[model samples]
Target: MPTKGMSPVSFSPSRASPSPSPSPSHHSPSSSPPTPRKTLSSSMIAENVDTAESIIRKWSVEDGSSSYCRLDSVFANDRTEAKDFLRSVKNIQSAMQFFVSEGTSSSSEQLVRAQKLMQMAMKRLQKEFHRILSSNRNNLDPESVSSRSSVSMSDFEDYEVASEEDDIQVTGNSVHEIVAGDSVSDLAMADLKAIADSMISSGYSKECMKIYKLVRKSILDENLYYLGVEKLSLSQIQKLDWDMVEGKIKSWLNAVKTAVKTLFLGERILCDVVFSTSPKISESCFAEIARDNAVTLFSFPEHVAKYKKLSPEKMFRLLDIYDSITDLWTEIESIFSFDSTSAVRSQAVNSLTKLGESVRAMLLDFETAIQKEGSKAPIQGGGVHPLTRYVMNYVGFLSDYSGTLSDILSDSPQNTRSPLPESYFSSPTCDDGSTSALSVRLAWLILVVLCKLDAKAEQYKDVALSYLFLANNLNYAVSKVRKSNLKLLLGEEWIENHEATLKQYTANYERMGWSKVLTSLPEENPTAEISPLEAREFFRRFNSGFEEAYKKQMSWVVPDARLRDEIKVSLAMKLVPAYTSFYNKYRGFFGREVGVVEPVVRYAPDDLGNYLSDLFYGTGAGSGSVSSSVSSSGRKVR
Candidate 1:
């Protein structure tokens, strides 16, 4: 028998002769004329014998037996050769009865041999067929042919055989060969091409490119299985030429783009299904898909912009999936480094940013609508259900993390150049001055939200007050530093010029009742009583005040002596009022009022000249002595 690697032989049998007729009855004398029918020709008999011999030889080698040599001993009579042949290869037969059978008998040893030989030949032919297939792979029909041919023989042979068994055959050809038609290849190529084309057209050219690279890597790296051979390991496979792989990838990308566009109907059904099912799937699976989609979508600026343009309803659905993914990521982050307060804080900040961005994108339409109609327009009820609750929970978590993070950072070396206050209200600084922009942004956003919520509005009042106090402190600190610098810049002559302006600003602030305006605001529903137009005007004024302050500082041309006197007087004025108020309100909290009120009143003496003289002489006088002197001098400054 031929081995697997051996070539197959073609068997072209000649036509057989007609069968002989039965003999006439003996009583028929006149039937002497009954002639003998033509029997199988000697050439045909020889052909049959040769076929049987070949079969016997093949089986003998295959089974490692010499049973074919005992044919004559088994079948003694030639006339019963066919019958004897059937009996020899029957269910049970002795060695002596095996060889007497003819090739055509069902039980014949020769018949058994012929069957075995035919099986071997068929296998060899199939091997040859596959060899031809592999050689002509470039021209083969992909649709009709099995791509499983690319799989290892051991891996897919059984499946291939099963498939072949079910397929109809043509004449003498096997199913596999018959199925390889032009139509099959055309269909398959069309499908592949369509996929490629759609990808390119849909602006997913990069993804298509990646697919091509993956295919080439799969093939060249031998990650791909091949028929007729054992599976190759990574090392066994041929290394891919990067240039060739690149070319293939490009081609595939182009094709994919075309195919994607052709099939894409802007139906977000698939996206919706995937996103909806993600929560039901394993977290890792969801993360992988989400990350992949994010990367793919964000890779193209146009796609990102397009995605941003999606209807609020659809965008919210996408954002829901993103939030789920972010939640999972947060969990993972916690698992890995939650013990490290800094790490936890960092992750929380990142998660918050991502969440914020997603929310902003989803609510963009709502924001636009609100902006256009003003907040009084009945909020289109369907924006984001449970969004506020979700945000609150996250904010609470963040607050806790922030506390921990602050503790950790407190232990680190201070950045003296831009130091934060020991107390929360010591000063306020612009967020851009901070190392942690996210932290500052989060703090501001939290404050804003708190201010917005009716229930939480009062809770945030103290926070707003704290911010304002800090801002005032910062201004005071900056002013103290700027005074010396300004004196140096303008020389002593301009001091008078600056002093007058400082006095004017103080008088204006007091007369305009700026502080009173702020203090009274909390008692009124500013939004309810104030029309939208008026509210807008208020915002404009609020912004303009800050802008004017900035412009004044930048353009100021103060005289040196007056600037020094102005700064000194302003500092004294600001501190005296604040300290006096503190003494009045909290003096009872102290064990002795003398200690608290005495220092405060000393600074605000009715005798300004006497207090200045005392201060100049570095003499700390009692408030009683200062008041008596002021009364005697009739110089009550207040």
Candidate 2:
């Protein structure tokens, strides 16, 4: 069955179907007709068109609208029909574009109609192009399969249906590109210089300084060369313009210098707004702002030192400035006893504590520097320099603040049952004998003062104990000096007076019927013995007769009556028994004669016997003469 010159082709289920076998009747006249290659001719195209038409007809019937109406109209051959056909094509093209762009592709009918509409629009465009050409132009053939395969179907679909307005470039393409060897450091420095210039022109020297800081951070030492050139270039260009950033910085420095001078002179009005307005606001707000500004000033010690080099007088002036501000704080503290609100009180306390800390730090620095300098020289008598004197004054102001803060805390309700906070108690002290660096010590002293004023015996005791401990543990170098000074300042009378005061208070408390002292007594004290019978008798008598007498007396003492009959009767009844008991006990103890008593015989003189009998057992009214004789005899016996 194989023909000559025909190569056999094998069939496999997985492989694409081999081209349809050529017909045997069309054999070549040579040894064997060359095997005819299988091709899809126009007849196959016609068959596909028929199938597609059939599918469109079924879809129209099922979908209730003919999606192929435009195709049908285009093939129709009348002028009126052709006009309608073109219009239909335009409508179909518009609808298909909308469906492709906005509608989902899950529906088979929508996808088919969209594809068909696109294909028809392309053919119309080709035909229009052909019509525009002259007759001498070569006929343009339909796209070949190879050429068509080169163009992606999805790309063609998008081009035909996508709206031009929706074509937006992605960020990847729109971003500014940085070329090779372009230094970001140089660019950033230039930007900063420009910002600094603008700020200067706008009268914002402080802001310009901030911009310079940012620029410094952006450029490292390794990239300084590049940034320096950029900065020089910018500076040159700005010089011809209105840029005065450098001038403004110098002006700022001058202003700072003036402020330092003013502060040194004790002029508070020239201080920063935060410092000047602090006393007028709530304690907390004042404290927070003051602390923040103080930190800003003291954060850079080296910078401050460099600034001081502008003038030796400026260095001394800086010390005066701190002293003046601290003095202001002292005055403010003196005006307010204690802030009523807790938050405000806390702020006030914290502010005072921070102020003390700052003063201490500054004093320590000055003291260290002075000591170092003094050690190298032949400074006699350990005399303080002018700077040291200013530091000491500043320290005194700190002590005053500390005292005020302690007073405030002592008056606070939260601190009622607790010891003073360590911040209040543990402030640093100067070893100098004077009260120069005595803020912490003076705070304790103030506590003692308050205790003395209020007569708080227990608090005084605690304070004395704490002070004694502190004095004893002081550094050996200053212990003797400080202790002597402390004794002198406190006086010998203080110790004796406090002891006497404590005793008086204790005695008063005891006399006021306070029984807590009985329990508080040392266990070594002897306990008194009491019989149960006696105790019961005493309590029973007290509960009965004592209560009745008290009520009767209390009731009988009425207005306008000197004495009431009932009261007199109650008083007699109550006193008679006590008097009788006292007489009986006294007589029993001392009435018996110590010497030997002679026995009285019945034979004794009748008068003496009668007299004795009357004295011993005289219930009846004794004759006045007999009673007088008996009294005379008793006196003779004594």
Candidate 3:
């Protein structure tokens, strides 16, 4: 029971929704510089009008469609103007049908005034057409005119255009001419066809709106001409036609493509259509159309291959698209079928649940897409890629819609959450403070990503490079997790675990690189071999080993300045004391050969201490400043 006694969801029997009237599309003004203008000529105007008429005539099935005459011709060579001219022609005919039936049309002041105005405007244009045709009027006799219906000025007084019609005729000729004489039903049907064509052409921008208006205007005119029913039944009057249905589908497809491809505008249009007030159209009809559209938008991409092909911008790039679709779709129920008393949001809940499933499907496909690429060219052993950042960012947004993901996992038999430590998610560093399933799930995803990154690090062949790669990636993940709301779910335990992992990587690096050199020093036994040559040889190996290690290792990267400093100190603690003591004991034993008084040691023990402290300090790694750093390390080593 539609509250407004509007017609039953009316549609044309033979054609799609009313043929779209030629009309300008709704357009936002361009910010770019103005396009160059082109001049309009009579010939261009005539050609365009001919083209426009052919399009309408081919589509409009009304009995006297061609007789519904004279759309204002577009003369300007300007493209926009040409289009407007074509639309104007359709609009003029729409007005013409209503104008003819005005004497018997509805009593609504607004509708009546609008029809009267169009009639008057046409009269003015007709006067102009006459001015142009005046020189040629001498060639035609009163009865010779075949295309127009002739009436005397007195006989045509009912339309209030007798004076205007008189101007188009020969001087004192009795005939006042009108171009058409279509019945209300025929005119209404014709207008419907044209309106549908227009909508298909540019209707979705505001279809529920423009179509309703055209229908209302025609109804007012139709009522004046013949007995019209208050309750309009689409099926009652004519079989609901396939052409109308196809037109609607075409418009929907176009809208879906627009929304799917964009950053935002298509979503806005969809939202507006979903919520527009159409008192004349049946709610059930609108709902069915909307549902159909939703199906087209979210369906079709069933598996990995299809989803991948539909959306090539995977990982983070799809977030904006995901957001617009999910958010707008979720709100449909609230807008369309909201129930105040029930706890359930009648249609929206189910709609959203389905929407959630659709999104989850697409996301699963995204994993397939990324993994496919990963198989071909494995993730590099470095910090997170920009694509990864975008994926994480989108997940952060998806946190708001976590229920959708939660629903997907509901069927799992195993307890999804890990047995938590008492301090899990409790610490400031890790806890997002949310205890919901979505929070836990998001936290789980974060851990999974970290594990994947760790595996990527293992790809590097160099043990030292592997450690550096791990350090860089782990550091980035830590920073992002800390900054994101994912922190709330990540909990203190996850943080503690990752932090411990970082320390282990650091320790591995220190042991492999710095510890080997520290262990190579000679024992400090007093009874052991003490020859100057033995001491010299030990110094020689130490010099060669330490210098090579220092030079080779210094340039190796450590990206985080704080972490780099910490590593330098930890290695220095192990190396500085041993080197210094060995130097002290050996310096007295190794005397200069012959008169060459050059120092036997290239660097004093103090230099060793300073050099250890400066290791892994910058992006370029000490920048040939090993000697300078030794001076700055705990012991002065000039």
Candidate 4:
């Protein structure tokens, strides 16, 4: 009756006609070899049969509902009763097996009776199996069971040993084991396992498995439903709006982690433990129970990837879905190791492949959009272009998913050749060669934006403003790289090089914009003595040049505060000292000739300072000029 080593045993009653001596039972000629209970007397056999009959009949379905004992209700507190019940079933089986081997008339009659009792016992166990599964749904929930299964006996022992240490700090590893195990009722698992083992050993595995598959499959499907994994088709996905698809993708991201890490994993663990004595049976059961649901869960991502209405905006979500599957791949492989569940693994792989394709396609579309941008109207004030903002922001978000992109683009084709000069679109300095694919991909996209900005800059008629447009847009792109995860991917060297190029653009703007004003002044040390008329001419030209430069540039913008201030400082350093030197040297010539130079020497050294301060604010050209505010001291009075 002990559950251990409960393999079926063979025995048979005598077939040599009834003995008039009433000599009890004896082995017949066709009887099988003797068992450990070969000497088990006729009385012992009858007693075993009768004991099993009493227990099974009590719990038989033939009884009215008032007297029907639900195994789930009783198995938890009365494990002794559960054990007794299993043992009784096994006893009935042993008795029937004995009768089958005996091959005698009376043995056959007893076999029929034992067989009836065995059937009743099996029927009761089947009900109990269904009852335990149905009633203990909360206790048998996958997440709780998974947490419990993760802890082993060694973990508990480790906890005990650590607890005994005098000054040991409990780091919660040991405590975690206790709490994890306590999350679910072990008694429920024990009851299910016991009933399973008894039924399987007694040649009723089909019934046991049928009940298990039916109940657990429903739970698995329900888990999938709650996880928000819908049975979406390609047509349906294509028809859904991006907003709805985005919501579903978000839900799937959350669901997949639970489905892969807890639901399927826990079910595998539960199946393995419940049918520990029969591994093949356990695997088959888990495969049948979870395969379809897992496929459905994994298939959702593929459906989303296959949606025809692809856009660059959806690339991040695709990357997210791809990343989730990649992150859980190892667990997925381990949980679905059985050949029967290979479709789940394949579906996951397919989803990843399709997602990579989708992501690549969207990236291409984004690049094409940048290249084909037809907005010819130049940004007023040479400020940041809309294309620049859109592209940089998109690339910045892509950099946040660099790790995922590296995996996706590792083997993906890239356009290594660039239309721009090598120096303009320089190679990125990645910390690892493995990330070169992503670095190159992102750098190329940024390069495409830069090229487009070049085309946009040409739309500005003022050559100086065109340079300013390039500087504004490039500075914006560089700043975006500096602030976001792009800094890490592109590296310091890349940032330094781009910043140098930005400096070049700034210098070009300064040269083209203020060159006329800078050249209007006499040499710092004039070679010839200047006549009064010549000095007046020099002052007139200087005043005319300064006003024209200031008025035109008043409306020009530099959006970055630091860059704006730096440019202002640079312009003042160049213009202020030279103008002061020239003015001090020549002002007396005008002063001595007319007793005042106010009519001729229009701007003071300090006035240049005030004028340069107002530059790059994008104030309108109609704004008041510094010439109207010049004071008696030849400086602009605030």
Candidate 5:
């Protein structure tokens, strides 16, 4: 049962309990006047008013003024005093309603006095409410508030269970354990709720809501500013340099995670708990406090996407922002679930859409960059072309973001004309039987680079060097794909196919580069009967042809050490044994019978092997200096 002279709607701040609904009999103004009775306790009502007046006056700001002494601070020191204060205010209101309902003309003066006391009590509560909010700014910070678990309402009656122990537990340990536990924050929330419940129930919701929105909105805006979220227009973002834009984007990425996960989420929880009795006010307060900042936070990405300078280099940062939002989509939906905050949700989604569109544009722009590469000069030594390095490196990095790109590219339209043959995609490159748009898109970019490489190779005038250029560049592409996530995306079969193409290029280079040297050796068996003249002629031709081929190819470069070693070993296999057999058979015979001015055999078989080892070093040094590499057969080429 409620206290005799108090309204029945009391709640204990320490206990977690729902607001009690007032009984109509307890609070409603009687429609019919009560019958007059001789036993009516007029003195008893007077005594209740006198008791409430003393307590109300004890905490009044002045003798009679708008401001009132803060009550929660007093409550913090002595909780019983707080309970007496709330009960006293309720008693004053109860006494006022009693005289009005009984229609007692003689008690009008006592009723008026009760109303004045009640007004004074409410003013004290309003000041106390605002004071607690302002003083506990750090204690009620969003991160700490958001980390609290939901309060479980006790089964017992809240008013009956109000205890000093509960108050001590709530206020004494709240600051130290605000994040680790919920006592301090709960105490603060319960206090705010108690004041809001009283104020709203007494028809002062406008003032309560006004103070709440003003303080909380300021806190939210300050937190957002510290988080580095800015509201720059598209033109402003466009005018910023790339480094500045990137810095802002990185800051946003960091800020958004905390904002969505803690700040806005905490505010929502705080509002709902504080204004539990008035849900419309809670929702309105939350929307007013959080929606604009959230929209500002999300709208930044859209502004960045609207940046006029779209380049392939900027794609990763855009994707980073896209990935950040994509990661928090479910949380964003839940945090801003209220219909009032739908614009915040819409802005997040709009930013994602714009970022996706920008990434797609960058992909097309990158392809255009490949096609329009106008550098006509051939790369020295037919090494890897700059276009090949740039494209492969770009594609290699793209593979790291395959999962994000899959979502972004899922709805993108397919290219009508690909640089590669239709058969390339149909091959095992799309080994999963389903080709994702990202896989196809990345594969298309790579093929554009390959086609561009084909054009770059033609810039080389030497046929053999052109083949070497293709071999070197294609080897680089295959190596890049093999080492990165591109292998999973483009599959083993694609690597194998490209490796096979690389081998064919290597073969074409070998066949073209060595034609003169190989053809210089006659097909006749060296043991067959041959005159000294024929023998001399063979050695002379072989020396001249070998020298010319070695000089031409020694300056050529094969940058990949494994590929370089493989080519050298392969050439030694083909060239070494044949020359060794011919030189062994002819050297002694030419020296004995021909009496040539110089030795008829200008090179030992080992000398030829030594020179072949020096090919592809890009040194172009003569056979005077041979590398320490041995022949293919494990013999030192001395």
Candidate 6:
């Protein structure tokens, strides 16, 4: 199918075939000779090429402009031309083997002249081949370009390449026709796009991998994935605006997308290229951005009124952080979950793990922000307390998703230990401690918050209220760790310290509150001017004080069942017995005075004991209190 004006190479079918006869025959030829696998074939090629060579040798070396055209027709400005040229030289080398093997040449002189001509042409072609290879290498390596299949200029200029292996556009024009483009770069892009779009999704990753490699090449050549500079540290990374880096990556991808729009590769490969070669983002890089966005997250909008009342916003922020990180890994997880190959799977896992590590460290930024809050001068007051509620609420919040977070934080030191450091009591115990780095950091941070709360608790002028405040906080701390999975970090020992402190507060509350009432009861004053009047008055004062204590404290709430009961029991032991005894001593005096109206029979010890039962319920104190001078149940009997 050579054009009318173009010269063609004539091929000899009979010589190429295994037919012993030189001329064409009607019968099918014998099975062809096996191609020599060990060495090149020295036999002359088919009659067509042999006849064409004679014609080629007839053309003069001085054929001027026609010679250039002839060579241009044969040689492409590409790797294909160099390869073909070398292959031809190899063929000539095999042909020349006859010069050595034909031991006795009857027409020796004619054979020598023909061999000389063939040798001259082989040497000339070899020299031209090297020069062309050098030129191509300077522009781009021959090996790199040679791997790609050649596309004819006609495929782009006019002819349709839509033979099904190359896709067509909506307009029915082929991808090659659309991007056949004038230059080598354009042709490569167009051909690659055509191949990619035409390829099916399933069972073609091997072929599709070529596209990925090409993308990597383009990225390296164009410097799309990196700048010429060195890596930045976490601090410096934080300072930089990543918008440009992200934007450039997006822009490069968009160009590839637009070029390949008509011939789409699956989204999976696209994502791989986009993320893998986008840039060298490190954990430190993610740490900066994740940290900055996370800074406003964990604290109260205004100062929280009490230690236990963190707003809902704090939990919401934590959930949002978890969600954002989930989104970040979504693509990688998808790729891994698919029926990917060993190499791609390994890549996905490595990517996910590194990303998990960096972002896990980024979660520590939340720790940093929380720790920074702990760094503030703690609030010092009775009405307002430290951020115990906020801190514990966050603990419960994080614990809810520990299973999922643990997967991400797995294989890492962060997931090692159970958290919560210590209470503000300066308790005699050190943490039982977790093995992982993350657990240690989180545990220490919890202790810091407690210490802050502890310092703030000491500010109260009323010792009983202060102790009660701390006791309530400690109970809550213990309950938070005890009830949730946080027991791992804040071990049983830490929780025991909280319980002990709570009991200590209960004891302190008893000593401070009831001591005043107990001292107010006057000793017998037999020598006084009005002994009977004095006795009645002492009964009145003692009765009033005891009633006041019960009235004021009945609504105070202690959450721990055991502590609440013990406090109630202690009050009962001290108040009931003593009050009953004092009442017995004064009752006769009241009646003997005759004017005192028997000093209002008031409480029997049992009546006062009932009032003490209501202390430290979850409800706070209320103001309907009147004084009551009660003895501990044992003291009344004494």
Off by over 4 Å in 3: 1-331, 338-355, 362-465, 522-538, 584-599, 605-638
Off by over 4 Å in 1: 1-106, 136-181, 184-638
How far in Å is the alpha carbon of 322 misplaced in model 1? 11
Error of 1 at 284 (Å): 29
Lowest summed lDDT window (length 10), candidate 2: 136-145
TM-score of 2: 0.16
What alpha-carbon RMSD in Å does predicted model 1 have with respect to the real structure? Answer: 26.6
Off by over 4 Å in 5: 1-50, 62-72, 90-114, 149-183, 415-433, 522-532, 592-597, 622-638
**Model 1 lDDT vs. the true structure?**
0.30
| Ranked by TM-score, top first | 4, 5, 3, 6, 1, 2
**RMSD of model 5 against the true structure:** 8.2
Model 6 poorest 10 in a row by lDDT? 298-307
Q: Which lDDT values do the candidates have, in the order given?
A: 0.30, 0.29, 0.43, 0.75, 0.74, 0.42
Against the hidden reference, what TM-scores do the models get?
0.21, 0.16, 0.44, 0.83, 0.83, 0.41
Summarize candidate 2's per-residue lDDT along 550-611 as a digit string, tens digits. 23222111111111222223333333343233323332323344463521111111232122
Cα lDDT tens digits for candidate 5, 1-638: 11122122221122122322333343357465544552365666677788878878888754554244433354466665666777676666667667676554455656666666766677677777777677777878899777753443321113131322245333332211233234566667766777777677666677788778877888888888888888888889989998999999999989999999889988988887788777799999999999988998999999999888768999999989998998999989988999999999999999989998999889988999999999988998999998899899999999999888988887677543344454454333334455556767888888888888898888888888999999999999999998998887777777888889999999988889887777666675655667767777888887777778777887898888888878877776677677777777767775554555555666766666567766776885523223334433333211
lDDT of 3: 0.43
| Cα lDDT, model 3, residue 96 | 39
Task: Give the alpha carbon lDDT tens digit for every residue of 1-638 in model 6.
Answer: 11221122221111121112222323347755546752242334322235434433433233353344434412334433322333333333343345334433422332344444444343333223222322332232222332222434333334223332234343322223344334543333343333222221112222334334333333222321232212223344334444543342234333322211211112223222212222222122222222221111111111111112223333333333334334434433432233322233343344345444444555565566655663344233222243777777776666665555555655666555445433422222334523334344445656666676676666666676666667667677777878876676445666676677768876887787677666655544323344666665666676677767656555455655665666666676665666667666656644444465344555566556545654555344322221344433422210
User: Best by TM-score, which number?
Assistant: 4
Model 2 residue runs over 4 Å out of place are 1-216, 219-504, 514-638
Give the higher-lDDT candidate: 2 or 6: 6
Query: What lDDT score is found at residue 69 in candidate 4?
Result: 54
Instruction: Write model 3 residue lDDT over 1-638, tens digit each, in one string.
Output: 21222333332232222322333333457645323331233234334434544544432323255453343332212223323333544453444344333322221232343333333333222222222222222222111221112222232222121221133322111111222334322222222232233333332324334334333333222322222112223242134344443343344334433332321222222222223333223333333333433332343211111222234233222233334445565344333442221222332234344444555555555555444435224334333444456556666666544444555445433224554433556533214343445555456555555556566666766676667667766766666666766566565567677889889988887766655476567755523557878777767767667776777665566556666666766666666666777777777675545565544576765566556654554333343333223454243222
